[model samples]
Target: MSAGLIDVHAHWLPAELFGLPSGSPYGAMRDQDGELFLGDLPLSIRTEAMSDVNAIISDMDAHEISLRALSPPPFAFAVNSSSEDYIDEYNASLSKVVTESTGRLAGLGLTRLDDASAAARQVADIAKAGVLAGVAIPPMLRGASLDVGVLRAVLRSAAQHRLAVLVHPMQLPRPEWSSYYLANLIGNPVETATAVASGILGGVLGELPDLRICFVHGGGCAPAILGRWSHAWQARADVRAGSSIDPRDLFRSAYFDTVTHDLAALELLASHAGEDRILCGTDYPFDMAEPNLPAFVDSTGLDRVALQRSGKAFLGVRVPQTELQ
Candidate 1:
């Protein structure tokens, strides 16, 4: 990179997360080898990137990455029959990783999103953790949209603290999405777009101007498909009749990550979401995540200043003007 990088979309799930013998929200089966099956999803902890912290730090050193904004994988935010302590323990585990990363990691906290009032309290608590960068949420929590009144209080709390809201999808919206793993490849972007749309179309963005949300997965389909959404919004009077603000501009005002893994997609994202509103992201340790994002971003024709500004804006990381190296 010639400078430095901060991977905003990295994960650091402890290998023992599924092994805890407490009140788990979901049923998990552990085999003799410690391989796990949490519901229908299988987890392999033997992977060096997923299991070994030292290996992760060494990789960051090799990649010239100064910091990693770590969050638990999306399943960690599942809203189920889980108790509050379960959530607390998980978030506490997340916080400890940040505290132990030797200033090389920024922790993105996790919170409950099913009920607005409870969600608000959790957001405040996560912010008070002091090392928290922001909170990451599933596109929808227990079928409640991001713009619903059920999430208003949480959003308000986040706005008050200037915490970044990372909108990542957790479930496929349809039953047939399991085919060929289309959900992760295509449904994820669709869900991300849905997340932002819920915010803008439901008036959350207009009501909370101070809120900073960064949609990962290259902003899903929201940025690139703005024209289609705008057209749909314009073509229907009922759609335009409710919103008090221009949904297009509101969506554009949001932040995005450079995780598209395609040069053209990143270009479209920068064009719409603003060049300064993007952060470096690779969806690290996931197969779909960019294998070498810094080099890819460097090749996207963005000069050093633009790159530095975008990274700083999305993650609030201070990039010195005299170059980041």
Candidate 2:
């Protein structure tokens, strides 16, 4: 078997997901054009490709990518007013896509953030259906904290079922984010770091050691800012009261993907998060996705063997057996 690259942070939606009236009445998303909008702001994604797995596979082939860990684009999870039929349809469609892909694709599931029990059930059900890479989540669902009991229930269930967690931000942090694609560039990392800290500072990471999570966008500066976060934790008793452990000391439980789009950022992520905690990723079919992951890895200053090892440990991707030798 030949060595293959796993783009672990890619996004995809079942074709049926698009063009449907949102239960949340996300009227902006249902404008008949199938375009993406963050906080009612339109994005530039080509809606047609989102539902087309063949187009996605062609993209993988062109990029020499063997497998992509597909997740519902963040918008899908924003459907706060979803119906059971809607949720079931989304999960089943995801499983169907992965099942038909013949090992070229794996998927993550979408769940409700407002209701933890429902989210837990969704996670287990999706896992039972063989869609096991993990489940898709936003940094903060609506305005709730990941550290809250409701979200904790979901993580605990994730631990029980052995499903990985993947985090993305649902919307930009501020109205100003509408300018310069700031949501994807700035809000994305900010949200990731904040969510990761909830696990680290909230004691959830220590409680659920079996849980595995991969943060997209090179962990969005969490690796770059550990020193600041650590200092704050030490300088303020209030901050220390949150986790009491050094900020740098506990993030070994966290995993990150190589979507930083900067070689320097990738190096910082590997060093800060540990080389093994970093995995291959490409936010495919989106403008910000790395164009050439193989090339990015080759030039990131980290050794190929170590990076590959780290990705394998974090993702547990099953490459062809011939390559295992």
Candidate 3:
């Protein structure tokens, strides 16, 4: 029983998801001469790698990943009522892939974040499906922060169903970040941090103690700014206006992925968030994905066994000690 790594942050977008019905929000998505385009905006991703399950497994074997959790990319999230049908179709298709993976894959379902009630119902359906381990949501929905709008219902439903939540950033373009690809490089991490702050400061985490949520991109910039947040929370009434829980305390309860792309940063995150709460992750099939995830984890000097356990714990998958050992 060799101890193999579990990746909790890889993505899978089946080719069938691209064939959206006419009324869907992303219905215009089409492959144009080998490039994927959504309404003429070219998406920069490896379509072949994202759509091929056999290739994904071969890559995982090559990279030494034992199991990979699959989630639809953020673009597949339902932003409007018109997207409900498409999102449902997407989740159904994703479940099929999971069923055929023979335990090599787990899936995270997507929901219609634009409508809280609909999203909550979808969360229930996702749990009832039994093949999905969690739900994936964007950190922001339609220009508002996640903590503000329909997310509360979604979070509560996920907690009730014991479904872990993965908060991935949408990477929407901003005027200031228009050039230099800052939308992805800088905006992504900041968006993740904002969601974490919202969860902690907005009383969401305190309200639901059973929620198992993991933030990706090494929890964005949240770990690095804990001290500053603690200081402000202690000194400013406005900072503690709604929630009295300590930022550092609740932040520790949350989970983070190992995608910092820097050893010192990973070490800092471990120091702040505790190594036991860290999980292995590779933003697979993307340009920003860690090229050598296993080697990168080894380079960080963190315990690989602990990370494997954390990933299993996040997905609520329990394995015997003998198997892990």
Candidate 4:
């Protein structure tokens, strides 16, 4: 494993958050046949791997990943409710995991998006905790865009604290995307693209210039539509109503993870977003994750070392050069 190989996009769930009893304050979650289900809907499979720190570290070692930044998957965000208590418990559990990893893991805390002021306070608390590199947020809050109202305050707080923000998608099942797992394969990317557009066209990126936000899944479909957005920005008045910042420039300023699952697509993203803005991400322990991230990047013909450096920059942490034995 390269000493500086760091994965900025990965997920971890503490055992305390799952397998809940009926009267639990955080709601009931059950583990049925090794699959985690919240109510009648299945939340995730591979529950063991998600909660097991040792297994995660071993998998990272096997895949030549020297370090990983862990966040709870979007399902754990509890975005539908104003449940700061659950968010607090989740972040506290994650901090303990980071401390136990012995330099192999860094944590990204969770925040309740329903309350903007509370969310900002959570960001401040996460920074003060001194163990988390950033915070993970869903692309939407209660069916509205991220830039809609008070959400911008959350982004502003993140920037002021110098903490990175991971914009992951927690896609709800739509009627049109019901079959063939389109909810994840198609809905997820669309959701991410929506968030990216909202951030750019709505002026969140321009307002918070210091915010270090990274979108996963190769920034969804945002890269492919940059030219169209740029054209609309220049040719249409309504498109320019929200903010005067060019969508292309705002897109370039943000960071993206290498999870496009295509060499040409990744090359296109790096070319436009700049090599320094591309970070290594595996979406680890999920069935949709890249099975062998190092090998996949090597096949892309992009510079792995540059991606390593980009991961370091996004996290704002210096990882020592220590090769795995």
Candidate 5:
């Protein structure tokens, strides 16, 4: 299948944002600050010159990827600690870069969810910016619940704008997770698990039935543990009292990205979530991503038709057989 694959998950950071050194340790850090601590990878390798739009295009040409959806570097998510003026300037700069890559690439805009109306207005503006296909928001904003008035307001406005939500988790506690290196190994997955758990248990999905949300890292281990959650709910009154709806049903309504990094894991995700709910993802410019991603996905157990249709449907594109494969 040499069809034009559309990667729904990837990240890019322009070099300009990180030239100055500024960011916090526990809170979200900027590219430059992260580079200083995490070493040269953030600055020297993952930025514009290193990521190389031309190189990505060449790689796509060889791999047959027609479209790629770009995300801000994970560090950009931490910009909430900066001034609102800085946030606006940062977003505008990102929008300009992404829009220029319009034909071959699309992007998801980022927003701080603390102010619902301002967030809603940003959503509307990004939609009209003619660059972004969706909005990427942190799973929990400042300590706000998914079903809270603020989040619901933003979601309603997102729904009105017909934007999909790409939910990623901010980094978690460092002390308890530090020893085990669990911040990513365990903490990241747990953060997403808790977010999905909260959304379902709180009945947020039921409220906004039409909203489209895509979960990264194969929904961060939600599929593997959903049954345990269900059993606990049945056995405990307090758990059952959280919401009347079933957690499994909510999982079905959402989507997952194919960044699991193993054939068996991918097969398990498909079994747990169904084929139609899965889409391709590479987590690009990160060392953890597959070296030859398109070929790896091509060889997965997924039905070719399902793989081809998933991205097109997510982007609202009508894929002809020739265009898709």
Candidate 6:
């Protein structure tokens, strides 16, 4: 019952770091004031208080979270911004906040996939500076997959540095899909699924076996379709012309976060991704995610050992001693 409560997937938006009317990968600019404030989080759930260190501690205490690994806003993943100044400013600011939040907070740095090498170097620098556990990169940047030769090198460099990779969807705008609210409902997950799957099927996993990848949003439905993919790979010879890895083989090598709210859904994700591959996440300060997520996860029919192994210990992060305060 007493597991190290590590929220492997949490977020922070220090006002000093990012300004208002921000761009979210979800296709909408967070209006200076909105409920689903930055990153599709609901107002009732995600609050401005997230910017306050003390308030964050209080919220974590209420949820029994011991250590929350803070993820940057998906929009910030473009570490290779149009401006070099952007990269320098973002990294310096991020390093300051993360380094100063010792004992209570840690960060998963974000970088632009388009320039993986530069991003990787920045991540290494951040790691050396301290207070960062990993780096977050989207599957694609400007429509290029991580499987591409250039980007693969970026991934390898990250592995060399022993930095964990958090892969999310790129926040791109699509006017056509806006009408149906598809940007988030389907588009986001679809993006995640495609990027991660491409890296696996493209032989990136085989090439760099030591890479530690944690997929967000329950791997964006990757688990559910893996069997079909595996069957196709075996049934059709050309299905894997360039890559030798069986589709299912790729799934086993990566890690996934249990951000899915549905219990049955979570269980199915675990079944495919496996208990060892699964970790707990709440996507704090987001409306789509509940505040009392740990309780909801506890309510699932998972056994104590399975829960501890899959949810906490495997992530290697300790639970907070008190909620945000």
C-alpha local distance difference test of each model:
0.72, 0.73, 0.83, 0.82, 0.67, 0.66
Taking the tens digit of each residue's C-alpha lDDT, what string does model 3 give over 1-325? 4467889999888777776434444445567676666677677765667788988999899987888999987777776554767777878888888889887888888887767787889899899878788899888776666567788788899999999999998787789998888999999999999999989888888888899999999999998898999899999999998688999888888889998999888888888889988999998877789989879988888777788888888988664575476
Residues 1-325, candidate 1: write the lDDT tens digits: 3767767887766666654324334454343354445565665433557656787788788776777788766766646633566568767877777778767777777777556788888888887777677888777765666777555667788998778777777645467786888877788988888888888887788888888877888778887778876787888876665476777788777878888878888899888777777777877776677777667877887654565566566656555554564
Best by lDDT: 3
Q: What lDDT, from 0 to 1, does candidate 6 have?
A: 0.66
- Show pairs that collide, candidate 4: none
- Candidate 2 lDDT over 1-325, as tens digits, reads 3356767788887655664325443343432366654446555666655768888899888876777788877767744654567667777788788888998888887776657787778777766765566787777765655677557777888888878888876655479897877876788888888887887888777778888877788888688888888788889987777676787877877888888888888887777778878888888767787888878877776555555555555555566654333
- Judging by TM-score against the true structure, name the best candidate: 3
Off by over 4 Å in 6: 20-47, 79-82, 303-325
* Candidate 4 C-alpha lDDT tens digits along 1-325: 4444689899888777774322322355566787766677676567677878988998888888888999887777766666666778888888888888888898888876767788888889889888899999888776667687556777889999999999998766889998988988999999999999999998889888889999999999889988899999999998998889889888888999999999988988887798889988999877689888989888887676777778888888777744321
| Cα error of candidate 4 at position 324, Å | 13
lDDT of 3 at 92: 86
- Runs of candidate 4 exceeding 4 Å displacement: 1-4, 19-29, 37-44, 321-325
TM-scores of the candidates are 0.88, 0.89, 0.93, 0.92, 0.85, 0.83
Poorest stretch of ten by lDDT in candidate 4: 19-28
Selected candidate, larger TM-score, 2 vs 6? 2
Worst 10 residues of 6 by lDDT: 20-29
* N/CA/C clash count, model 5: 2
Tens-digit per-residue lDDT, 49-122, candidate 5? 22356766666677667777777656566434534554566567656655676467766767655577877887
Model 2, position 140: C-alpha lDDT score: 72
lDDT of 2: 0.73
Candidate 1 to native Cα RMSD, angstroms = 2.8
Clashing pairs for predicted structure model 1, backbone only: none
